[model samples]
Target: MVIVLSAGKLILTPTELLCRLSSGATLRALPDDIRLVTTPPLLIADAGAVSWTLPLDGVECLDDITEFYGFAKE
Candidate 1:
């Protein structure tokens, strides 16, 4: 699980190891030559940094993110 700041709030979201391999909206060190499957289209900057908003709420737990990504802790 990874905590990301989105829309001014800290949201706990599932982090997939493979996601790191895919190219993001931000031109970070991600692999750009390959296509991705079943992944959320990320908003990235040219610098390879992810573009996210911090939510108004405080830090969230992984359980709270299940609805968004259908993730379940193993």
Candidate 2:
């Protein structure tokens, strides 16, 4: 599944971590979720109970994703 975090539609903070998955909607998460997972190439984010491995290996949205999650560009 694909996640998109631009505005504050989704919430992922010290107190809360949320991800509402839809059939064909945008999936969003916080920076901390990914940081605790790994690096840029391996796009991973935790949704409390489970971890999501995004299938964006060579997509242009990677830049946007990195910026969105405050990931260090590699």
| Whole-model lDDT per candidate | 0.30, 0.49
lDDT at position 20, candidate 1: 27
* lDDT at position 59, candidate 2: 42
Q: Highest lDDT: give the candidate number.
A: 2
Worst 10 residues of 2 by lDDT: 1-10
Give the 10-residue window scoring lowest on summed lDDT in candidate 1. 29-38
Residue-wise lDDT of candidate 2 within 1-74, one digit each (tens)?
23453321233444333444434444555566663322444456776986666544344446645555556654
lDDT of 2: 0.49
TM-score of 1: 0.21
Candidate 1, 5-66: lDDT as tens digits = 34322222343212222223322222222221222322221323443221223324333444
In candidate 2, position 47 carries an lDDT of 64
